[model samples]
Target: MNILLYTWLGSYTDDDIERHIRGMGINCRRIEDTQVCNGDRYHNDEFCRSFEKILEDADYDCVFTTNFLPLIARVCYKKDIPYIAWSYDSPPNLASLEEMDHPTNHIFFFSKDDVEDYRSQGLDTVWHMPLAVDTDKWDAIKTAGRDIDVSLVGRLYSSTLPVLMSRMSAEQQQFFKTLTDLQLKTYDRNILKEFITDGIAQEICRTYEADEDATLRPTRKQLLYSASTYVSHLDRLLLLRVLSKKFDTHLYSTDTEADYKSMLPNVKFHGPVSYEKGMPEVFKSSKVNLCPIFRENVSGIPLRILDVCGCGSFVLSSFCPEVAEYFREGKEAVMYRSAEEAFEKVEYYLKHGDERESIARGGYERVKADFSYDDRIRRMLTQAGVLKK
Candidate 1:
């Protein structure tokens, strides 16, 4: 099979998707087709001409890409080529779909609910094809001392946390004993305060330290409690703080290693790592992959979940109903109700490698079978009518 993957090459990592397709003995070429800056009036004259030449000469069987790019969709339409439109976000309403003039055959989405949602909105051709991970890249990593118990990957979304915390008023907290009861382990609020302090200190050190008289920026915790509700970095900070009290925690981002270490001397902080090169080591070294999100619904399962699972490492993630669609709790991956529960699960799995390995293997098998990149691309091609059944 010959395929052309129309995508943003440098955006995140699509190597897995490409590898998976090639692994199935399908020849694939990635062509960058569109740019977002074009906005509503899509125009990429150079790219369109180049893409047209590729499509005209290659005799490829399938063209898979995001439908959101209208210019590319227009090119595909002109060539009478069947194209698969991939959508990762929530499906648009009927009105929105009607506005999109391209007539794509296959619409690939992340969850079945999204498929149903699009169908309800009258999209007859939508298909459920979840995001995938590169099993080859995200494998077990090894570390020296088991220095940290919990660690998180991904950019911090700090604004959402305070809104959740402030709204949990005394009355609300008292009324919903469910959240409290779910706290299987107790967490020290002081640890959270420490996280807030460290975040502020780091910010000051990085940008404001040159001015000796500069006032300290309000800590994330203080901002959450204040009248102005949202601080985008608060969610990760809050989750980190709560987790820190329960176990030795680390924050490993692409940057901020030196600053974070200076702020929180005890907590392990490693700076930015090259995704392709550094991820494998992190997965093997860390005991538990902490996947936490403050938002619901729109908080779609991240690509890292599959990566961590593929690596044969245990994951302790925030509860999301959509997760049940891919992994079975207690069988494939662990889900936690609160920080304390998250801590306990991490500790439990760390000691019981056999059980942890069992769940890890289950997760890896599930991802390899259902969420492999090759499987997804093929499904899209088949549904798009680009490849005959």
Candidate 2:
């Protein structure tokens, strides 16, 4: 079967996703809608037009894209080719009026809650299918170790950081105190309050600001009823920084380069490396991979966990709902509830290489069995009726 993937294919995920589908013997073509200048996608008119040209030229039985490029899916829909989109996280665009602007007949969603939301909006054309990693590219490799304790490799969401900062006022403090005290019954609220009351939230906002030079220090927040992804974000950052005092730590993201260098001087900051060339080696070298996400509405596991596990390294991530659903703690991977927990877990794994290696092998096996890219695409295609079941 011929498949056209309408994606911004410069990043690690998009490239690996296409590579996995093609390896399954499907005639897959990539229509990248963005230009990577200095390791970032420049989404201008020229980039969109270039992507459209590629889509127009490619002959394919179906098209699979994320909601980021609904226009390509619209083109496929108009051409009468089956278009199936895999929305990795929440369907922000698909849930918006823009979704109706160029509505698709077939859209696959990762979050079940999102599926219900779409259904309520009278869009019955939705299916639940989570995103998977390309095990081939992300799998563990046996390389001479790079000295790093913990690392995180995702974008810095500036949008949410201000919301976290906004709650620092005396007026907002009362509201936060009440809400947190109420939440203390179920979760860790004291730690949550320190992040809010101690001006840590504002510091988080200041930390993400890029220097005038944009390279001197890499810096890299939340919501309330809004969405406090900062607690989760800072949790990872603080955990890594604390670890750096004892062991070498590194970060591999562009958004956080300035933050890492300024706030985490001892921490090695390797700004976004090419997945094709650098990520595999980086993942292979690191002793343990950290997936630190403290977002309020996070769904599906972070891609980094899969990337590290697939690369054959032990993964240490937060013990969230999705992580628990996919992996058995201490068996497939290690999990922690707080920075204290993360420190304990990392220290334990680092000391016992055999235990870490055992967990890593189990993680790789689990991903190969259930979370590989080929398996996800095949299942998605079959569900969309683009291929025989």
Candidate 3:
């Protein structure tokens, strides 16, 4: 079967997906649909004209992308071609969620919570799928020895809470902090919505209106989004502060929302590393890689954790129930509930080299067997009805 792959700015996932589709003996045609990708998310006349022509002329079996796009789904729905999207983003994009119910679209979410949520709303197109890694690439990466003790490779996000706090009554600020603390402690799911009532949301909305600066207006959803991001930032900071005091902790990222450089005095802050060249080495070379999952994520396995395991490296990550489905705790991976557990595990695992190596090897084997890019592509295709079972 011939497939058309639509993509935008280079995601780390697209190339691997295309390669694997071809490996399955399927003709995968890629179109960089950056025109519509850059334009209106709902409708783009120029791209609609261009995309229609291509699909009609090529008569491709299905259209695929690394992440779900509403624009693509709408076009495919009209043209009568299947559109498949494998989401890597935890909750996927909020805008994309609305278009998921289109009959022609098969939208796969890495997060089970997303599928359950949309499905609860009776979205038939939603399906649960986990993120995958190109194991072959990671397995080949050679690192001399494990030197880095503890590390986190993603951002220390900036939160609007700080700015919002300036305007809120002291009680409101405390309420906001309480929400973050409660969300952080409730590891199984993101319960931000439960506590964020309409009254509270209205209060926040009114506060933004009173802002002296014209640029301070943010919608209720935006405020909630910020709250989620802030809590995640706090979660990462909590662990980083505690762990860095004891272990040789390092954070490698392109940028930061907070002043992690100054804030994390004990932790070393190396600027960004390319995913292809430097990331795998960091994974394999570290005695323990820290994956403080984004607070918004529910049961989806973050690609970072899988990538760490793909490198045959040990990981100490924030708690997520789905991780246990594929990996044996204390054998293939380590999951921690609180900041204390995370700190304690790092202390224990650092000194135990043999156990760490064994777990790493097991993790690599597990991902290679179940979560390889090839397997994920094949599964996605079969489920999307692109490939014959």
Alpha-carbon local distance difference test for all models: 0.60, 0.62, 0.83
Pick the lDDT winner.
3
Which runs of model 3 end up more than 4 angstroms from their true locations? 207-220, 256-258
TM-score against native, each model: 0.70, 0.73, 0.94
lDDT of 2: 0.62
Q: Output the lDDT of residue 281, model 2.
A: 75
In terms of lDDT, the poorest run of 10 residues in model 1 is 184-193
Ranking of models by lDDT? 3, 2, 1
> Residue 99's C-alpha lDDT in candidate 1?
22
| Candidate 1 overall lDDT versus native | 0.60
Summarize candidate 2's per-residue lDDT along 242-349 as a digit string, tens digits.
777877677777765565568777777767877665777777777877776545434557566777777777888766566678888898888776667777888888
- When 1 and 3 are scored with lDDT, the better candidate is 3
Flag the better candidate by lDDT, 2 or 3.
Answer: 3
- Candidate 2, which segments miss by more than 4 Å at Cα? 9-11, 35-60, 76-79, 89-97, 100-104, 120-122, 138-142, 154-229, 255-262, 294-297
Q: Candidate 3 residues 1-389, lDDT tens each?
A: 88998887567888888888888788888887565556677767667777788898987989998788777788898898989888888766665356677889888889888898788877888888898988887767798989999888888787877787777767888998888888988787668866776678677667767776634655556667788899888888888999999889988887643566677788888888889879988888899999988887778899999999998899888888789777899999999989999988998888888998999899888898889887777887888787788
Q: Which 10 residues in a row give candidate 3 its minimum summed lDDT?
A: 212-221
Best by TM-score: 3
